[model samples]
Target: MHNAEIAMIGLGVMGKSLALNLVDHGFQVAGFDLNSDNVARAQQEAATLAAMPGKGRFLAAANLTELLAQLATPRVIALSVPAGAVVDQVTDELLAAGLQPEDIVIDTGNSLWTDTEVRERRYQGKLRFFSTAVSGGEAGARHGPSLMASGDPSAWQYVKPMWHAIAAKVDADGMPVGPFDDGEACAAYLGPAGAGHYVKMVHNGIEYADMQLICEVYHYLSEVLAMPAADIGQVFARWNQGVLNSYLMEISADILQTRDPETDRPFVEVVLDKAGQKGTGLWTAVNSLQEGTPAPTIAQAVFARAMSSQKTQRITAASLFKAQAKSASVPDREAVLDDLHDALYCAKLAVYAQGFDLLKTTSERQGWQLDFAAIAKIWRAGCIIRAIFLQQVTAAYQQNPALENLLFAEHFRTELAERATGWRSAVANAALQGVPMPGIGSALSYFDALRCAVLPANLLQAQRDYFGSHTYSRTDQPEADKFHLTWNATPRVQQAQ
Candidate 1:
């Protein structure tokens, strides 16, 4: 019977789990993959997991023709293939597979938002193309994930029920306390054409900054404080109970506690320091620059990753620098730890501020009506950066939708004020001890520069004008009235000895 409510292509880790998740939510799911083995494996997984209190049908289609044949009319299909060229290939294949103009297609991968925009325009009137950025990785797909959807409103409406059913739920306090009667789904309609993916890109950028902050703390604990990895895990565990609570922080603690089976030492100790990325963070950084937004925290995180890649150069430099430096010193251990925690909190606020600023600029530039509150709400669960802190973000936007920057929110401003002393103390101490704290350090600088009403940029503009005849705006005149001055008044003549 061709009564399958929805179809999913690409039965890889995320795809298969999402298919099963739909099935568990009582939606008849038809799934297909290019590899026959993958199809068989997905079928087996669905069967094993379907035993748990679900009454939906699951169909495994051997090919695209079979998959479409099983789906109901006005078909809804989701693609989970690798982003970039593969997505275009799949869409072309679907068109070739006799998909009607009325049918809908959803791309739920890490495709660049601009690429999504182009795809939407390409498929306009030919087929309804949608982009929904899924977060929370494998575990989220298997259970529930945060869904950010964009493109056609009709497409969003068609998938709304399924999205809500399979998305993570948040409690009244905006914490992920698991699915329950009194909770909200972590999914929303972001806007048209690329808005959803753009938001997801910002999420990944903030993730990079957040991760670097955690690593900096870990570095301080290990190198400066002489704490063992297991003990450092305890510090993270304690922090997770406070305002610094987050899924990433919790997992970081868990990772530090894990013992390497071979040597029976903490797994983190044996792991290499080099970091790898999948481009989204870099996209966010580049987009920030394009938008003329200051996202130094995110940019610094990307630089940190790149710097870590030069292991040999850094090792030699460390030895060379060691000879010129005095031994690192610290105040009371507990006091330093307390200050570091507050500094981390302050830096985290800066990172998220920069990310949201990028989103705000992008929304204005692209004409997408993005709801910051809704974005924050959806991120309260399932997504990698989910935290109790996002509840504060939701509240900030709710209090003032027109809030220009997150740091301008009264609550956050007060929080920063209360923690300013400790934050400064931590930064000063780290700098004095020759410990690198790029994430927090960059955040502090960004915040200070953001709040400064006067800056040295006027001199920069004058220098530009002197060198290249670039116009400079006067402080006493309207900014639109550009002025330029000739720095060298001497008449041009050939120099002679």
Candidate 2:
């Protein structure tokens, strides 16, 4: 099985990494790239590489025509490219250029969920399509990507062996449930075309929120606590010891510790502060709003990145700065750390909450039974955002399968109560001193959302009465159909049944 036919399209960072991974794992891989240089180099590299664990050999396709002719009829084609209309165009090209109907085409790009659905139906009865989300960035792309795949169930079963060769392990509960044995825990046929993308969309959304919140904590420690980035890095390193620990926080520590050549200071300062979003965050926010789910943490992070881009407004504001900067009041370092830990933990939970809600809502809309607990476990390792606290989330879901939100989890509530006071104090301290802590603001908003008594805008029924003549009853009045027209300042028109 060292020569299983695999053809990879695109020779960019992700494509190159994955193509090489296939070559390493002993699978006979044929690689193609639009760029002449990259393709040639990849060809040279593939031929030179030795057999790796569970992968195959190497072949290079000079062009589309050559590649198609060289590979077996029912080839496994991997598409690693930019998302949106580009995917459709490329797929169309493949079909137009004599790609076989029995071929297995996998889209490893982070395409939109709706588009994946459309593509699946468009190619129905013609070919098998798998929409998979691959994580771990460029480096992880080669070693292995934590992949979420969804397509025809039978097709997924046929491709299971290849999927395992490319995925990390652990069941959905984050428990060390599966070995690198029977199956790949990190990858699964999430039930249909859009499901994988739906999960990945929410994944990026949570990522945006998590990174922004981390930045806030960084600012508080640096600007307020007068701690060095190196010290902050050390703290994050220590956080890995407990449930609050994660891969993002771990890399954050390394990033903080990395030094700059010119200033002899942390390289974090040298890097541009203006956070750049790649549209996934915005897409996640829009979807949440459309589905009537509250994704405040991720939404705030997108907004925070926007604020970072406004350097000129900030410079202008700083020109008239109040000369008296607040002097530091040294509280118990351990106690303050405890507060940060609690706040970070709670804020992170909110990020996951937003993402899970997105998945859940999407699942309902799509008619799929996606196990929430399973996603948590698979994310525990081999993903960019892997964190120790994922174990807690996994356990939380396991304890109560039917629970609506993570906030209602008993274990989480008990944990929050123990340290929430310090967290609140830390957030308040930043607010009092006029520090623009977007992450902290998001954390506060998350707390408020958890404790929110009533979402007034939840009155979709009243609006229904104003338009389509559907009626809603208050919590106190179960059977009443009268519309609450005074709030909208419009007369309600009741439709005869």
Candidate 3:
């Protein structure tokens, strides 16, 4: 126990599971929690693992001082605490408890990337501050999870071996290599300071878009096509075996088929409709705006969640505004489904494109030098957004690291071109039928806008100039040269300083 390799603070579900995972990988762990019961439970699980051959032990520490004493010199401690002030509190407490210089602290919470940056600078002289954004929830923690590590390269040197051992592994083809398969670890050094957390934020943003798009597809199938939950589940199961295969889609299919034991209704139908978010998606949308990057699909997904929360208002509005008249003729169900699958695939491309573009823009602005291909490769498994589609994304980046947008990739470009007609038809049909398809519709709009060379922005600029005197740059003139119009004067336009 005195030779414990690492210490884990906050033995909640994620913390405890991760501690056990390290023990399973034969790393001695010293675990502590504010809740004594949590520490006891983790100790019991660790004891069970230690009983097995080739497993390491877990030392339960009573306090911060004891936790530090159990670890070796230059201790490596991981905090699974809630993000924000609590993290700072723990760090300060550790400092007060005789945590020495050169000791490494890893924050494994869903922290804002900027906060990570602040902490790194705040803790610079006292100790090494590192952050690793962990994804895949509790189960993934107990077995394996995608790890995005950043901050303090020296600290990473000490932490890398353990992180890699416990991280989810993937095959050469970008498919998840399960426990039995031989594959490389999903962990990698993303960049400096807040790079890892920023990547994780963007990952959550894409996840929001992905889930909403799937839900919108489900809504179309259930409401417009008159399909039962189980029937829709079957459709999703079929899709899961194809190009759209993903962890989200696979679970979504399973969820749709589940029954509520109490009322004998579909599990989804029994559950409340209001969605919950923990701010990462909103952060991504906000960051995109600040960076001047267009991420309409991601923004629309966040908006859809917000709209879902207004259940009472929606119910009242539904009563006041009668439903639109049904279409004169019902669409062919199979044809619609085919179109939907294509539409979903195309929209997914847009969603990923936006997420990656945001990452690239932020990386350039922040000097993170993030490896887009590596990010895509790691995401192919052990994450909420894991999908076969990411394999293509990985190849796209590997083929050309400077890929401006995912839509421009040859593989994705061909897919989008081939599926554009069906994608458009599905969206048009959804609109005509009065079905809301915000995620899908916004993605299509984004795609169309990107492809258009000339937009209505010229008039927009003119209007801005007319009202606000904001100067406009002309296509004929150098972009750096600006012009203003005096609409009331005889001369319509004049050069501006």
Candidate 4:
């Protein structure tokens, strides 16, 4: 739209909220949605707002023609549609409707980075493409959402004020834990088209892992201490005051504390233990595997949810095996809570570390200015998994923007050293007592990956050298670039020289 307000192509919950935010920021906005209901709702919401003091009002275009007529040829239309083929479908349709390459199309959905990569190529030098991951869901979308966007750096400047107008505030640690009450909340550019989605993908992946670890902690309490949900929640609430303080953990406590309206019993029992997973968590696990990243906890969390989906089979099978609700003799509640929290804190760090490592690796391979510390700050505010530790991540990035990896950072090293022992013991205990602590195992894996001196695959070195004349390094002299190789015996041959 020639010097017009931001236009939205999909006016669903997220789009509507973003549109309203634009309106609130004094941008004369125009929107179009396939669903008539959403279109009508936008109109209704617009009608309820205070009369514009001096700006133009928001309009819901009746059709593509109407929307095109309202905006400039190279429109700044953001798509909040579903990811995958549908995104491409909309882009193609918009192109057919005379949307020029000079136009800007922002995909504010959780599209795979690959999609963004492809779209960038397909658009070539014509249109601009941005893969933006919008966080904060329904509520955050309206007031403010942490925006991770990547595209033409020049075009980025055009909408930056809008991003600032809508983002959450960052803290001293550079994390986003709240809306920018003073006008600096959640949004920032993440580099290029696919960069935003890639970062967001990792964010969700970490979220998956973080939530599972919290659940595992609860599992340890319920099985070992026979503690009820509320009591376990109290333990988490206490942890919230320390290093483990986080949005997910805090919400978990709220869920447990919530009472039923009818029975006055806990509302958790009323809700299904069987949680359903959308594909992003699983996609993240798959991405990690393909990229040779250590994402065990997130992968396990995805699997755990899948297993939860088999409720009917699980219920039926419980009858097949005669089992007692055996309770392990728990240590003192205070002691157990402290130990578990120490374990949880370490595990959570490991989880974030693993994810950040992946980002570092990805940024190196691809050209994305990840700004790990900035990302950590953004995660702090507008997302589902906002935690206090993200500040550390942000600071780490700010100090060394080209930080090759996270574990090598000095402060992180100190933090890990202090908490890792207890975390390791927690995992060992879980393994010893048959506790399913995938999150802890993942956390352990982070330490293992960062140790540099040892690797589980090192045992295969001899075998590696035996077959292909491949070389192997000795643990004794790792700092030295020396490697040992056992060449396969070859038939006697004269030297070519």
Q: Write the per-residue lDDT of candidate 4 for residues 437-479, one digit (tens) a residue.
A: 8777867876776676756676676677666656776766764
Global fold similarity of model 3 (TM-score): 0.97
Structural similarity to truth (TM-score) of each candidate: 0.96, 0.88, 0.97, 0.88
- Per-residue lDDT of model 1, residues 1-497, tens digit only: 68899999999999988998898878899998888888898888778767777557679887778888998878999999999999999988988888889899999999999999999999988899999999999999878899999999988889999999899998898878564344799989999989999999999999999999999989987877889999989999999999999999999999988899999989998999999999999999998999899999999999999999999999999877764324654558899899999999999999999999999998988889799999999999999999888999999999999899999999899999999788888888878777889999999999899889999999898889988999999989998999978767746778998
Angstrom error of the Cα, residue 419, model 1: value is 0.8
Q: List residue ranges in candidate 2 displaced over 4 A.
A: 1-4, 51-55, 170-184, 321-328, 454-476, 484-497
lDDT of 3 by residue, 28-123 (tens): 999899999998899888888899998988988889999999999789999999999999999999999998779999999999999999999999
**What lDDT does each candidate get?**
0.90, 0.77, 0.93, 0.78
After superposition, the stretches of candidate 4 with alpha carbons farther than 4 Å from their true spots are 1-3, 52-56, 72-74, 171-180, 316-330, 464-497
TM-score of 2: 0.88
Clashing residue pairs, candidate 1?
none
Worst ten-residue run, lDDT, model 2? 175-184
Worst 10 residues of 4 by lDDT: 175-184
**Model 2, clash count?**
12
RMSD of each: 3.2, 5.4, 3.1, 5.4
- Candidate 4 C-alpha error for residue 163, in Å: 1.6
What TM-score does structure 1 among the candidates reach? Answer: 0.96
